[model samples]
Every structure is written in structure tokens, then in C-alpha cells.
Target chain A: MIPLILYDIPSKLDGTYWSDNITKSRFVLGYKGLPFQVEWVELPDIAPRMKEIGARPNKLADGEEMYTLPVLSDPNTGALVTDSWEIAEYLEKTYPEKPIFSNKSKGLIYAFGNAVISLILPAAKFPIFRASQILNERSAEYYITTRQVMFKVKISEFSPEGPTRDEHWAIIERAFNTYKEWYDEEVGKWLMGDVISYADIFIGSILSWLKRVLHDNEWEKIVNWHDGKWGKLLADVEKECKKV
Target chain B: MIPLILYDIPSKLDGTYWSDNITKSRFVLGYKGLPFQVEWVELPDIAPRMKEIGARPNKLADGEEMYTLPVLSDPNTGALVTDSWEIAEYLEKTYPEKPIFSNKSKGLIYAFGNAVISLILPAAKFPIFRASQILNERSAEYYITTRQVMFKVKISEFSPEGPTRDEHWAIIERAFNTYKEWYDEEVGKWLMGDVISYADIFIGSILSWLKRVLHDNEWEKIVNWHDGKWGKLLADVEKECKKV
Candidate 1:
């Protein structure tokens, strides 16, 4: 069997993979026991490279074209799928024997994942400096330029200190607290139940990104706030990944 | 079997029930084919009446006491459950023959419901004036006072016609579009799968509230925004409810 080709953004400084979007795809592959090899694409080359591989841009609800990373190239079928959520769906359909979304409610999980992304984005902004430090000079320049265009401000403006950072952290804390409330209400080891689902994969990937970008103390604060659930989940996913 | 008693806030003018919290319980009962009767309680009377029925104030994550409506009293088990989400869980557990949450991942659904609540709160706030008009004078006064305290502003300040209201509506429209993106991703009739779940119940209740408070044109604009999914879901829920 040919190994799947997972296209991901390479970190500038370490040449290591560190994207939440790519982590999501890696998680699903790891969970499904699918053998895959990474194809490192630089930050600036993602769009053109993905398009060269025949990966089409995903259309938003308003018909806006969105090009993103974590594009998967299935060797056996010669199928190239783009977008993390779409890749998950493709893998689930292609590998029905090992289901990521056991209940076939990927929509609900996707909704929750998007909500988490929105909640985490504000806090995630505060860690831009740390994120930039890990990027090589070229990728760092690309990252900062794109981010500035998106945020309409300098990357340094999102420093992880002072009143503004505190406000963003507070928003993130409230979002997690809201999640914890729901988690506590249900009797489950995983987000879905005793069995893990793509929701866990999505959350685990987000945590992985935070772990990569946030300082140790900052990471610990968030991990501790959710009654150790976040830490435990990352550990659980790690254990699950180790099995394959 | 004795009918379950559902305590809800009464509509001031119509002497009807219109609370989203109450609709959650009603949806469960209707879905389960359970016999239940609404015990109308005024705004100020909710806490005392619930206490009289042995429903204690719900404890928040921070251990704060919260007194809210949609309290259910099941005579068969002498169980009193407060809070909408809790009531849904109670109903599901007590009457397992007809399941509302088929996935057994109530936590995920609850998280989605809470996200919806947060997203809709801003847009929903615009309809308060219309909501107040339906309330009796006493309940209206109580509602205004409490909302003023909660929002730290006068109730009249939340009128539907203003630049601020448009901004709030834009936020809600974006939130709904985000949801529509997820909904469009999966091949399912409901938020979860082929069958309706508590998620649909929660969403439907919010729609019901909007329908009750907003003018025909305003409500239509929102209903049309989400690819007609919102309007369709409410209709589907109503059809499902009619079965009981």
C-alpha cells in the first residue's frame, strides 16, 4: 500500500511542522492507522503548491474562495483533498472500517470545531511573537505580512502582556469555562463518549498549536483552568496515536 | 403515569409560554410523547415557585447560585430538575424509550447550544422592546429592571432601530453563516444526523423566540439568511411536535 502524502507548512526556524490545520490532518491519519509521509511546503508556497497538486480551493458559504493548508494526497486513489474538515470527511468515507465520527454527525463536530477556532483566535493572537520566533526569517516575513494584512495592525501589537492581552485571555477563559460546563454535564471520557471522535482530534490539534506557541506558564494556566481536561485529552490522544 | 409539571414564565399579554428555556423542556416532552402541563409563573414568581416545588437554585461553575426557569417536576420519580439542558437530560434518562439525544454525546450538543446562545444574545437583545410589549405591566417592569441590571443600561437603549442594532445583527449573521458552513458540509437532515437531537431543539427554541419578538420582515430576513435552514428546522420541529 502506498503511503498517503500529507502536505503541511514547515516551520521556518526548526523546519518542523507546527500548524493546527496540519495537526488536524495528522491526528486523523494517526487515529485511523493510515501510513503517511509529510511533504513540507513553505508558508509562501502553500497556495500555488496546493493548486499544482490539483487541490481545489474550498468555497465559503458566500461563494468566497479560501485556500488553506493540510491538503492530503491519497496515493492509492490518486485523490487530492484540501481543507482539514473536508480531508477528515474524505478519510472517513474512504476508510469506513475505522470511523473518526462514529455517529456520522461530522457537521455537529465541524460546527463545534469552528466555534473553538473563533474562541481561540483572540487568545492565539497574543502568542504571535512566540510563533514568529520559531519561524525562519523568510517564513517569518511572510507570516507577519499576511497576519498584519488580516489584522490591520503590526504583529508586535499582539504582545502577550498588559491589559489588551489580559482582555483576550479573559475571553478565551470564558469560552473554555463554557466548554467545561458542557463537558461536566455529560458522563464521558471523550468529547463524544467513551470512544474518541474527530471533535477530540480538532481540540487536540488546537491544544498542540497552543503548546507550540504559548510559553510554558501560559500553557499551564489554560491546561489547569479546565480541571486538567485539556492536558488529559492531549495525553489521551498521544497514547492513542502511539498505538498505531 | 402522572403528567410531568413544567414551570415556565407566562407571556404577559397572551397568557402563553414563550421562553426559549421552557421550549427546550417542551420540545423534549413533545418529542418523547410524555404527558406534561405548563404551570405558568410570572417573572418575579419563578424563583420562589421553583423553590416551593423543591427545585434548588442551580450552581454555576464558579459555585454561584443561579435561579432560572424551565424547572420540571416528575411525579413518578419525584424528581425536580432545573435548567433547560438539565431538564432535557432528565427527560432522556427518565423516559429512555423515546430518546432525544440519540448520539449519547449530550455534552457536544450542549456546547453547541451554549455557543448558539452566546452568538444569538447580541441579535436577540435587539428584540427586547418587542418582547417587553407582550409582557404584563408587572412582568414588563421586572424584566426591564433585571435586564437593565444585567446589561448595565436602560432597556429602551436596546431598540431594534439603530446603527448599534445593525452591528449586532451583522455579528449574528456571520455566526449563522459559520454554522451554515458546517451544516452544508455533512449529508444530514438534522444538525446531528437523520434524526432530530437536542441541538435542533435548542436552535428551534431560539428561532421560536425570534419569531415571537421580531416583526415579520425582520424575522424573514434572518430566516432567509441561512439558506432557509433556520426556517426549515423550525417547520420540521413543529411537524415533529404535531406528532404528539
Candidate 2:
């Protein structure tokens, strides 16, 4: 009878959501019409709090623990799922009806989900830098500090501005262009033809993140590419999942 | 109805097959229970011959026309499908029976098929060199000559024996290992769980090519990796498509 709780880290500015994965999980919840409450855990508290709630850390290659956002705790299933893709799997498993992943293509969807992430990460430096800007003061501090150490450069140094930022933007545009070629013909307004599936959700989620982060002019530049493909898809997502 | 004609490049040794793509197309034909005849086109003649048959060339980035194999001409529909993924789409659209692609996952399957090829291409130097060794005399000569000119190295120089070949093999093994990590559990033998789809066919075709080209010891080494995952999948493919 109780609603599910989605654990996410909130931004400082009016506690708005920012992470692509969190936005995706929210879309799933909204799409499924699942009653869910957002339980905002600040970045610093996420690790200790998540572990306290028996949710495990995402292990790095070198055995380091990585506590991440968008951990969905389904009170109905008495399970806490971590990682964006894993959260998708958990939701699909728990809520069989209103399924995002088609049974026939669940495995392929998983691969494509990973593929989408890979495509996004190549030009992610800008967004990665911008991400810290939206976080709460302490979380932003934690983010800038950790990421600076991680990249051996200040967050500002990553994206810089002007030509360098433009190069990163071009990479993203090119990546999406490569994806645009995947369409044999633009018959339907979706990846799986007329049907709206997880494939759309995956890319749309990232698009949503970019839309939220990028300045209006930058977002305007993107929405124009491929005859406004990204613009149209985001519109469809918003129309389909109003709660998201 | 007259049988469909699959245009392919045959290896020299008594007209044996060696191409990954042609083999994949063969798998599709057999799996669909469609009657098809192989029309062996020599390597040098493929572009001109295909152009004569009203089949188009796959253009390179430089806009040069490059004709490739596994072009399927269906006498029934009067369709000449070029490229492996395009062939898959054509077959699915035309036959619409005994479907290898689940309509729900067709888009994702295409993406996964492309992913499989990308994973295979990095360590393809050995296979690229070995490919010439199997071709007919004129074709082998043409292949070595063209490819040597392309790479600015003799065919023998590309995949020279010793540690270099070993390193190339390791890349392939590591690629497959990366794929192995994609699976969350060892539940089913197939990529899309119990059901075999185009994703399996794509990778299986590459495995078949490797098996045909690699020495028994080298092939055995691959078959043993990932707990005989590649070996078993190829077996399943062969069993499913006897003609292939």
C-alpha cells in the first residue's frame, strides 16, 4: 500500500534534480504510474546512509567503493536496487505491467543502454564540470574536490570555454549524428518504430540531462540538429510522463 | 518460387566459404527455412558484377564505391539486399515468419549487431591476413596486392608470427571477455536469454569466420575461453541453420 522511495541527490538551487540516471529512474516511475516519493540524500551522506540502509556500493575496478545516486528502494519488493541499468532491471522485474523493456529485447536494450552511456561520456567533460555547479554547497565542494583530484585538474579546467567547449559540443553532435544514421528512414518518431520503449527512454534521459544543464542557446543548437530529433523526443517524453 | 540467390566470395580450397558476413546471411536463410543458392563472385569482380546485378556499392568515407559481399537477391520479391544488417531488416520485413528478430527488439538488435562487429574489428589483423590465404589464386593475389597497398605493408607483415599474433589474439579474447561482463548471470546460453536472435547470429558469424581461419590450436584456445561460450553459441547456430 505504501509508495516506493527513489533515493537521489538534490541540487542546491531549489532542490531540483540534475543527474541523468536519476532523471531516467524518475521517467520510469512516472511512465509506470508508480507511486513514488523522492528521498533526497545529499552527496556526502549518500555513501554512509546507503550502506546503513543495506544498499551496497558500486565497486570500482580497483576494489574501491562508489556510492551512486538513483538507488530505488521498492518497499513493495523489499529490495534496494543500485546503478541506473540495474534500477531499470529491478523496475522491470517488479512491475511487469507497463514494462519499458520488451521481453524479446531486454538483453539488447541493456546493451544499447550501455552504448548510449558510452556515446555520451566522450563529450561529458563539460557536463561533468557543470554538474558540480548545481550541487549543494558541501556536495559541490565534495564533487569539485574529488573530481579535480580524479582528473588532476580543476573542474573549470575541464570544459574551459569558447573553442574547447565547442570541440566537446561538436563531439556530442557527431556522436548523435552517427546514431541518426542508424535510422533507415524516419518513418516513426521512435527508435523501435511506432512503439515507445526503453531505447528511447535511455537516450531521452541523457538528452533531458543535457537540456537541464546546457544554456538555452546551447540547447537550442542541439534541438536543431537532425531536424529537431532531440527536441521532438524530449517533447514526447514530457507528454508521455507528465510526472517526470 | 525460385530460390533466392546469395552472392558471396568463396575461398579457393575447393570453393569453401570463409566470410563472416556471407556465413551470417547463410545462417539467416537456413534459420528462416528459405531455399537459397550461393552465387560465388570472385573478390576482384564483386564490385563490377554487383553493379551489373543492380546491387549498389557500399561507399567509403571518401565517397569511393566499395562493393562488398553477402548481397541477397530474392527471386520471389525481386529484392537485392546489401550489407549484413540491411539483409537482416529485409528478411524480417519480407518473410515475417519464423522471425529471428523480435519486432519489439528490432532496433536494439541492429545496434547490438553493429556492436559485435566493432568489438571484432580491433584484432582483425590476423584474420585479415589469413583471409587472403584461403582465397582463389587470382583473388588471393588481388587481395594481397590491394590490402598491401592499402596498409603500405605486405600481407605477411601484417600478422607476423610470434608475440605479435599472440597480442592480437589476446585483444580478441579481451573483447569477448568485455562482452562476458555484460551478462549479469549465466542463466541462458543465448545473448537474449533462452531465445536466439540477431545479436547471437552477428557474433556467431564472426566466431565461425575465426574457426574456419584459425588453426585448431588457436581455435581451441578461443573455444576454451569464457567457459566455451563462443564454441557453444556457434554450435547452436550451426544446429539451428544446417545449411550454414
Candidate 3:
């Protein structure tokens, strides 16, 4: 068996967190029944190994660089994988016993699933989200202000009839509508099908993060559908952190 | 030899050019000098196959939303791959003779290469670069106005003792300034090394787009470097397109 090590860097102002996409990869690996050791090294302590591995410097100023997290290493293959989504792909490919992207037919579905989740990583990291705590007292006002700016940009990019940016609310609302319509058509526990594929895991991870960042009860309920299904699986894997 | 067919939707919108990253796969496939077909299908003509393939409508306006373009159908494997980068991976994996990501290293370099290219894509699509005829008369003014807004955002984000957003400037000015610090490093022809990796193709595509969009003398020099490297290769591939 190849020894797998996750070289984790500590969180900083740049929105690095143990629960971010990098750590979620460990969960995915665990879900696939893969054994890996976690070497949780804080940023200050990461210099030597990073240099040895020729890891690029973290670019984001407030926290660690966005590109640097969740570095995966397999000494046997002498493979070091970075980029959270790509790491998931490597794990799935390397360990085919329990497949993540089980079928190639559903590649786009899985890609979109992963893309949605990956989108959350940035959306969650938006400076506004970090300022959420400080702006909690003025949450409504801040939300209105920031959301207006975002909406203005969206409307400017796509006129009343142009292709809507899915990241925008109107588009996201439409996506939810589409998902709901599809769910109604086929009552499946997962997004793509009966079996959990990478899509389920990807959307599940983002839903998990959404549940964390969203404060409103209505929004919580909407995102919680995922909790009843894949959320439980993610939480179970997350419980492994305690054991670690 | 597997029969591969690529359906492309050409649009200036970044998402439309699905064939961008996978150009190398197409290049390698053709250079294997195998027989294949490349079909440039406009958005109007791509609905039926898209539904059959279960592509989620990415753009809301198109109710008939298809995933990113350049969907490849491999009759031999019965695989229909979507998402530009994944298509490249499939091509490399399935056709190992002339591998796109030749140095496996478990896809570490491939992921970073893709990421680097992604960063360059947005920079290329920054309106002024793409439709210079519309913006050229006002581009100088536009550049100053946009830079000021970006600088203000940077100041607000990193207030008081503002860490120089100069790196952002460095990336933008890369075409104009050849002697930037990163350039002095003699980091080979590409970011990774001598061998042409996906990063080279991805970065090369973005650089090409920038050259076409920017049309500045300085950027032309940058394109000249790319022309000597990736551009020549792409032109050779254009021959295969004629056959397709």
C-alpha cells in the first residue's frame, strides 16, 4: 500500500480553514475507504517541505495562497497532488475499488457538481463573508449594499435577455428550480442517480458549507435537503476528524 | 484507433470555446496522425445530442443549456466527454501513444497548469482585449478607470498599510514589461519544464487570445514568443481541422 500524506496548512485571514475544500478531500478519500495520514503543519512551519516539493508561495495576502492548500503526497508513486478537485480525481482514479466518478457518461454532471462546490469555496471566501461577523450588527444593511453591487455587475454583464450568470441569484434561483423539477421527475436521493457519484459528493460539500455560512432559517431549510441525504455522509466522515 | 468527433461552439464568451484547452489532445490525436473528425457546430445546432447526453443547461437564457463546448464522442469506448480539461485527460488516458499530459506525476502539474491557464483566461476576456474595435478608441481611458476601481478595491481590502497590489499590476504588465522579476528566472519555455504540458497549451491558448484581443505592440512581442512555441504547433493543427 502506498503511504498517503496530506500536508495541511493552517487557516489565516484569507479564509483558509480545516473545513475548506482541501480537508473535504480527506473526507472524500476516507469515504472511499482510503487510509491517509494528516500532517497538519501551520503556515509558518511549511517553508522547508514546500521548498523541497517546489511548492509555489501562497499568493493571497490575508491567508495562505489559494493555490497551495491540500497538498497530497503518495511516496510509493512519488506523486504529490494539489488542487482540491484534482486531488479528488486522483484519489478516485488511484483507488477504483470505491469509485467517485464511477461512470464517464456523467462526467459533466460530476464536473458541474464539483464546479458548484468549488464555486462555493470562493463565494464563501468573499471578503463580505469574512466581514459578516463584524457586520452582523449591520447584517441587513451590509447584505443589501454588497448584494446590490453584485447584482449591478450581473445585470450589466447580461442584459434583461442575455445569458444569466449561474453564480448570480436569478441564475441560482433558476438552477434550484431546475434541480427541484428534476427531483420531482425522478425521486432519487442523489443528484445524478441512485448511487453516489462525485457529483453528489461535490454538491454535498458545498451544501455543507452553505449550511455553515447561511444564517437565515429559510435559506437553511432550502439547503438542508442535501443534509438529509449526503450531509449525513459528510458529517459521518467529518466525525473522523475527532478521531484524528 | 478510436474514432473521435469534436463538436465545437465558437463564441467570444469564454465558456463557448471548449476546444481551447483540449487543442493539445486534438493535436496529439491528429499527430498520432490518426483519423478523426472535428465538427464546428454552432449553438443553434447542438440541442438534441446535448439532451441525450444529459448536459445541464449552463446558461439559463438558452433553456437548452449545454455544458462547455468541444464535446468529444469516442465510438470505440462509447465515451462522450464534456468539459474541455476533462476531454484532454480522457484523450491522454485513452490514447497514451502521444500523451497530452505525458509526465504523469499523478496529474499534479496538469492541475496547476490548468489553474494557471484559467487565471490567464479571465485576463484575456477583459472586454477591451476581445473587442478592440469597440473599445480601442476608449481603451486607454477604460484602462485607467478600471485600474483605479481595482486599486481602490485593493486598498479597501488591504487597508492602512496596503500591501502592494503590484503583483496584479505585474501580471497585467507582463506583456508590456519583459524584464519583470518572474521573467528573469529563466523558467524554461513554460512554467513546469521543457516538455509540453497541458499548462503550456492552456497558457498558450490564453496568451493567443490576449494577443488577438489586446493587439498592442508589446503584447505582440509576447505572442511572438508564443508563436515561436505554441502558435506554430497550433497552426500545424489547423491542417487537421481542414481534414476534419
Candidate 4:
């Protein structure tokens, strides 16, 4: 049987996948032990490629549709899915034996992810801005240009230095600490007691992405925060996050 | 065994409990089959009562701590709990039988509650504004004065009669429909599949509030929304939401 195909974007420096969104899909595939092949689509070519595959484009905040990567195609079932969340849903539905999300925890996982994201976005803006730096020339240009429009600020102003940057990191540190409390309350190593599910993958995706994009010193700070909670989570999922 | 004492407020029409906040604690107590007694504390008297019981005050937006109702004291454990969410936590911890929140889903339940509350609070303004009308004279004055400051809108302007009200209800209907999809996808009648938990109680509390405070026509519209999810949930919980 032909392996599933994952559309991913590569880091310009090494021509390997570096996108957190792409990593999210990759991690889920690895977790389920699903055989999948990766195809690199540069940032600029994503729209046309998505259009070619009939993958759904995301609606931007202003109601404009924008194409994105981490598009998954299942050769076995002839199913195509776009967006990391939808890809998780499609994979879980088509391949149910090794489930990423049990029916009981699916909605709650989404809710938990949303809550964490809303808290972290202010701090996350820093990593997102840094992420644009990893794209290949044309992809980098496309990413920066589009993001500037979306962010309504130049990339230079995105993650500032001094007190403002300190505040961002402070918020980031505090946010991680805040979520650690949830994990602390639980009985098992995973978020949902003994069960390992999509919430772990979602969080692991963010941490993996941060590892690749953040400066070594900044990354060190994260690794140390919450008694190495972020670092340990990355370690836990790193095996399943193998490059396709 | 001395029954748990729950501090509550009553409607002026009769000295019976009509508060959704108080109803939430009552519902949980009933669900746990824990015997509880209610003592009515008029709105004006809530602060003194809470202070007297050593129940913690809720911090306002500006960091001012203010007393509120639904303060529960467990005579068995000598535990004094304030806040509905905390009350759920305390009950589950102290009782440990017929738990409102299982250890695994507790954090996720909180996450889901926050998500729903964030969406509903705007539309909920109508009922909250109306709630003041049910209070006795001094309580009514205290309720309106505190709320008008918190809402920063006069009671007259709180739930306006034109396009703005339409927009608010539209948002309310849309929010319920959106959450209903989560329930629809699940295998069981409850939010988190077959296992009933605090998420259901949280949703039920808001629905109970709406039923008591919304106009007949407005409440009817909610009863029919999302295939009568609101109405059915009220039915499901009303048995437990007794006037203790």
C-alpha cells in the first residue's frame, strides 16, 4: 500500500521540516505508527499546491481565505485533510485502532488546547516572529510579508527587546507554569491520566517548534522553567516527532 | 451527621432560593447525595456572612476582594469553600464518592467551563440585569449598584430592545449551536461522552439562570435552540438543583 503523504515546509538552513504545524501532523502520524511520506512545498507554492490537491484553505481573521501546509493525503483511503487539527480527526477516524483522541476526551482536548493557546499567544508571538527567519528565501519573503499584514506591524517590531521582550518571556514562563499545575493534579504521566492523546501531541508540537526556532540561550530558559516541564515534554514526544 | 451548610440568597416574591449560583452548589450536593441545609443571606448581608464563615472573597477586576454567595461549609470536614468551581473541587476532594469531576477530566472540565462562559457572558447580561429585579429592596439596590459599576452600563442600557439585543441573542444562539456540535459528535448524552461530570453541571447552571431571569419569550427561544439542548439540560439537572 502506498504510504500517506504529508505536505511539509522545510527549514532553509538544512532543507528539513521545521514548521510546528507540519510537525503536529508528523507527530500524530508517528504516534499512530502510520507509514507516511513527506513532500516539501515552499511557503510561496503552498496555495497553488493546496488548490491542486483540493485541500481546504483557512479563513483568515478578515474573512479572507489563505492556503496553509500540513496537508495530509491518505493513499490507503483516498482521503485528504488540511490543517493539523483536521488531520488528527481524519487520521483518528480512518485508523481507529491506535487512537490519538478517545471520543470522551476529544472535545475536552480541543477546549484545553484553546485555553492554553489563548494564554500563550502574546508570548507565542515571539516564536512565531522568529519562525519567519527559518524559511527559504522566497518562503521567508512570503511569510514576512503576509505576517506583517496579519500582525499589523513590521517583523522588527514583532518581538521587541528590553522590558517589552522581558514581559513576553515572563508571560511565557508564567503560562507554562500555569499549565503545569493541571498536569501536577493528574495521576499519570500524560495529561489524561494513563492515556496518551492528541493534547500531548499539540503541546509537543509547540515545544518542538520552539526548540528549532529559539536562540540557544532563550531555549535554555524554557527548558529550565516549571522544573523542566517544557524540556521533559519535548523529550517525551521527540521519538514520535521523527522526520517523515 | 450534620448536613453541609450552604449560604444562599432568595427571591423577594418568596423566601425560596432562585439563584443559579446557589443552585449550582445545591445541584452538586444533590448529585453527591450529600445532605445540605440552606440559609438565606440577603444580597446586602452576603459580605458579612462570608466574612463570618471565613469563606474567601472573590477578587474583582481591580484586585479588590468582594464577598459573594454560595459559600459552602462542610460540617463533617470543617471545610469552608467559596466560588462554584472551587466548591466542585472541594466536594470531589472531600467526598471522593459519586464525584462531580473525575481526576482525569477535572482540568478539562474547567477549561470547557471557561470557554462556554466567555461566549455566553455577553448574552447573559440580560438575565443578570433582570436578576436584580427579583431581590428584596435593599438587596435589589445593592445588586443593581454593584452590577452597574461592574457592567459599566445602566440597567436600562444593559439589555437594550433593538438591533443590539438581536445581536446579543444571535450570539447566544450561535454559541449554543457551536457547543452542541461537540455534544453531537460524542457517543453519550453528556459533553464528555457517557460519563457525566462538572462540565454538564456548569452548562446546567447557566441554563438554570437563564430560565429564571429571562423573559418568557426570550427563554422560549433558548429552549428551542440546538434541538432543545438548553431545555433538556435543565430537565436533567432540575431534579438536583433543589431549593435546599
Choose 1 or 4, whichever is better by DockQ: 1
* Candidate No. with top DockQ: 1
The digit string of per-residue lDDT tens for model 2 on B130-201 reads 888888897988889988987788778888889888788878987787677654332577776777777777
* Cα lDDT, model 3, residue B8: 59
- For candidate 4, the per-residue lDDT at B224 reads 81
Residue-level lDDT tens digits of model 3 in B110-163: 323423433343333242323423232343344445544644542123212223
Query: How many clashes would you count in candidate 4?
Result: 0
lDDT of 4 by residue, B216-240 (tens): 7878998988777779878876664
How high is the lDDT of residue A179 in model 4? 76
Name the better of 2 and 3 by DockQ.
Answer: 2
Q: Second chain only: TM-score per model? A: 0.92, 0.93, 0.57, 0.93
Candidate 1 chain A weakest lDDT stretch, 10 residues: A9-18
Model 3: CA > 4 A from native: A1-118, A121-233, A239-244, B1-25, B28-33, B36-200, B211-216, B220-244
lDDT of each: 0.78, 0.79, 0.48, 0.79
Instruction: Tell me the spans in candidate 4 whose CA falls farther than 4 Å from its real position.
Output: A13-15, A59-64, A122-124, A162-167, A170-174, A240-244, B13-19, B58-64, B122-124, B151-159, B162-167, B239-244
CAPRI quality level assigned to candidate 4 from its DockQ score: acceptable
lDDT of 2 by residue, A47-88 (tens): 889989989788765679899887989887798888877887
Greater-DockQ candidate between 2 and 4: 4
Task: Give the TM-score ranking, best first.
Answer: 1, 2, 4, 3
Chain B TM-score of candidate 3 stands at 0.57
- RMSD in order of candidates: 2.9, 2.8, 13.4, 2.9
Pairs clashing within candidate 1: A12-A136, A13-A136, B12-B136
